[model samples]
Target: MFRVVTPKNDQEFEKYFAFRWQYLRQPWNFPPGSEKDEYEQVAEHRMIVNSEGEVVACGRVHMNTAEEAQIRHIAVHSAYHRRGLGQMMLGALEAVARDQGAIRAVTNSREISIPFFSSCGFVIEREAPTELGLLKRQQMVKKLTDLSSLVLHPKWCTELQKTWSETIPITEHMGIKLHQYTGKTLETRASLNKNINVHGTMFAGSIFSLATLTGWGMIFLQLKEKQLEGDIVLGDGDIHYHKPITMRPRAKCNIESLSGKFSILESNKKCKITLQVNILDDDTPVAEFKGVYWILPGKEASDAKRT
Candidate 1:
């Protein structure tokens, strides 16, 4: 549970000002009592608080007619700095700007804060003055276009969730029904090996299959959502049993990040994509598999998509 706060009253707004005084002004030795000015009247201030009811981070934005705005007074308590609360607050400000019809959001960042802004996908535009005597502040902005990639239509995500739930148990029972199990990319499992004396280790085959399945699931779902249909298949795969696995298995696929190449199938044609699977023990990767998938096309893929 997380809450993004925008101070709408005198007390919270003053707390907003105090945050800069405590984290920025006091440490940087800025001109006394001049750290914050009359901007609170027109600016939209945001804060994030912990469950203990203490404000841990704050930021302010002056909405200058939706299309453009300036962000200011960003600060986080020393104890809570690295937890990304400040970044989260900035995200909220960007949302508000969008709600106000802004197609882009901008910020003026201090030198120390430039890397942080860059990591968040902002581009530097110009330099400006700061309270600490002509500090070369950087101006940056990010267009709201990327926002569209995030909207999931809810129904599609829910369907994907259901597919994951259904597939896990089926894959776990794979060898029980068919001696040959298949998968997509990275996978990790515990004690799928017949050699129990190996101290609870998983078999390479099982781990490989699980990873392939996971990647196949993601690609299958994503393509289906786009109205793209195919028989997504694992034509060939390789496994590298890195070290040993002694815990219950978990797995993942890496199509989203890997560049490589893949193809889509239609009708009865065969199209393929390579899937890399990683098997892990309690979140630490232990074994791996690379799976080559062939899209079988038509009914098989479409039926799976519907399910």
Candidate 2:
């Protein structure tokens, strides 16, 4: 629900405190700087915005030592409290720590906040101090452990099984799961009649999503064969229709050219490739497609104990 943390530069520092009086020094009447400690300069501040572009929540973090990190000054606007904004903020901070080689992450929670952090996978070890006068805090921690095997990379057979398991509306939707890749070639027959015509042809939108997904299936096949671990997401695309299908439509794709479109990926973190699938009616070309799709990098881990 929130974007990545952006460290505030000269242009963005003034927006941190929203109703600092209500959240920080409201009840006990503590001094102004008690809530905001010395971490502002060195630590990273992440802000969350609602659709209206108002900053509703904010968090600050700093690397405490060589092997540990700490989170400080995590606050959400009163109207937005109890929404798990704090938990999400910590999760984002934890990811930053993990990527930076931290072995452990810690946070000191106010008395009312101990239960919240505990539910976010932290364990309290002892009581500590707080900015508000005469308040006892809880010492909480979340350990950083190896997460390599939590990902699952599926194969041809495994993918088909997954598709079946996740498919829906068994009575209305029909799928022919191919056993393996057959060189980007797919031939499916669809009933067509003159009554299906707007301009004496099949509806264009039906052919669009179908043929686009046909090329998508081809990439799915190649990824299955390569055993490369990643998720395929459609970043963007463009489609062009060439002719009309007045009769049955047979479809085929040339993945070699499509594969060449991805050659740029070897040096880049992401790639966008255009694919063409010719829709033919009994050997007569009815429509042609020029579709572009964005491919992002993704990896997921499976459950360790369950597997």
State every prediction's TM-score relative to the real structure. 0.48, 0.47
Candidate 2 displacement at residue 275 in angstroms: 24
Model 1, runs deviating above 4 Å: 148-307
Best candidate per TM-score, number?
Answer: 1
Model 2 per-residue lDDT at 19: 36
Model 1, span 1-307: residue lDDT tens:
2245556678976776777678767776765576676776777777776657578888778776648767777787788666656656666566556656777778878889989878766889877655567566888887755632122233554454466557556453543111111111212233354323355666556666566766666566556545766656667777777776675465644333233333344445556666565665533457666777666577666776678
Give the clashing residue pairs of candidate 2, or none.
150-301, 150-302, 151-300, 151-301, 151-302
Query: Each candidate's lDDT (Cα)?
Result: 0.60, 0.56
Span of ten consecutive residues with least summed lDDT in model 1:
176-185
Write down the lDDT that model 1 would get.
0.60
Q: Per the 3 Å backbone cut-off, how many clashing residue pairs does candidate 2 have?
A: 5
Give lDDT for model 2.
0.56
